[model samples]
Target: MLTENESIIRFFKELGLEVTSIDLGIASEQERSSTIQISRDSYPGVEPHLVTIADIARWFPELTSSGDIRLKQPQPDVSNCESLDIYRQYWEQLLSVTDIIMGFLKEYRTRFSRGEYPTTSWAHYFMNWTHETWDSRRLEPAPIDSWICYVDPSIRPHIRELNEFGLITRESCSGHPDDHPAREPFWPYVMFEERAYPGISAHLFTLADMACWIPTYGRHGFDVSLEIPRDVELTRGNIESYWNQLISSTRQLMPLLEDYISTSGVDFYTNMSNPSLFRMPANFQCKDMSTTGDFSR
Candidate 1:
């Protein structure tokens, strides 16, 4: 029986985002409604889209190791420049995930009456139901930790970017020989982490594996997941359907994204091959959608 405003407030509350104020300026006097605003502190910062390499090193100085070849300038003893291309990949992935979630919320609010929305609570939809869609294979939510965030091949370029900026990074093939490109796919990923010690590093460690932000994109559509009597099961169809929708949604939001980035002092780089792309401030890298391997540095 909660009002839509109340539901939104509750939803953000569970996620630990503080609500700063509710502006009623747009509401007619007789309507008695307002727009809710979240506190700016909830966002990481305007400086970098994600955490910076310098900050990561400062927080986790244990990145250097005894066996590491101490270079004159800052550099890791071993390097897999090829795998480093994925460093900034997470930014778009994160943003894409966020946009889709917002899209879900908007759809939910539009389709359901204030008090008759599905689900016991908004948090349930936000956390558990974001990824479930009909006519799609269920996507198992991956954990959002240093392994996925920093060490994953998708963000290797991001790590290398950090290293180029005087932040020391480490990489080990871990007995996987470098001569065989055929076995490269199965090689264990290098950990882009500080080696000062074992436990003191502030490596990337987001709980919920970013799953908390991904809503089920299955058959029910975004709004259906928010309503009562919703089906939680995955439907069989083109697994690419949800991803396609997400891509379409991202395309739709590009104008707003460009404006927001500009206002936030961020730069856009369409070419991942640009040598300076990573060194730039809060840069958004947009590679050709068809050519994923071209960005490998």
Candidate 2:
């Protein structure tokens, strides 16, 4: 039988993620462990949280592509009143989704793990009886180019799962240790694209629900955002604890997202009107989640 440490490394190897570091947190040595943690250089910089109006213009050029309106990235001394108005409209759409998600998380907790605990290898649970986490990790879907460059192994599958609900992820970080010489803002977070799909209400609510149901939430709940990218920040400070929650939570999220699609409807953006779909807001509109291809000129 491969040791838990090796199991983790093998898991990442298959996922094509470069493991920068791995520390099998043993419950005996650490207050609570047995949850293996690893850090890969999958994501290079701090995930962008509060991007400027100019950033939105670049991200969703389709919205700014009228012959009358053009956007340029703001230089240090530049000010943009035109883009500012458009930015407000974008933010309003994003905030509408955030509000819906917040309400859902605040109202429910029964389906989530009430407290953080040491769980066995996910590879063992999800895979055949052979290697524990190794097998389980193999079953996870491969990451697309954009996601592979940013989303860490633990969080990548969930990103893919989000797509099943008609959501698009913009950026993600599995998180670094507090003492890793970085600011806290470089937290464990998953940022979603503020797609114009029914205005992102479904995406926001799903992420908020992810925070509540993700294992080990009893102590370390996520900090969901109200601004652009509309992310949820994991509340753990230590790297090991952070990865544990991220990876372990994913095991449940996969099936849950499927069940959500099966019960509510696979076309997530189209199903916003389904009150059972995270009890979406009354005025929520379900629209196509695709952006018109990058509008050049």
**Model 2 poorest ten-residue lDDT run:** 43-52
Misplaced by over 4 Å in model 1 are 1-106, 114-232, 266-297
Tens digit of lDDT per residue, candidate 1, span 1-297? 986446545665554345454432223433221223444234221111112121222111111111111101112223345222332232223334434434433433333233322212212222234322222322222233444243444334433443333223344222223323366433222232222111111111111012111211224323211011112221222212332333344334332333222232112222223222122233222211222211111
- Candidate 1: residue 44 lDDT (0-100): 22
10 residues in a row with least lDDT, candidate 1:
62-71
lDDT of 2 by residue, 79-195 (tens): 443444454454344334323333333322222233221121111111122222211211222345645645555555555665445445555565544433455545445554432
TM-score of 2: 0.28
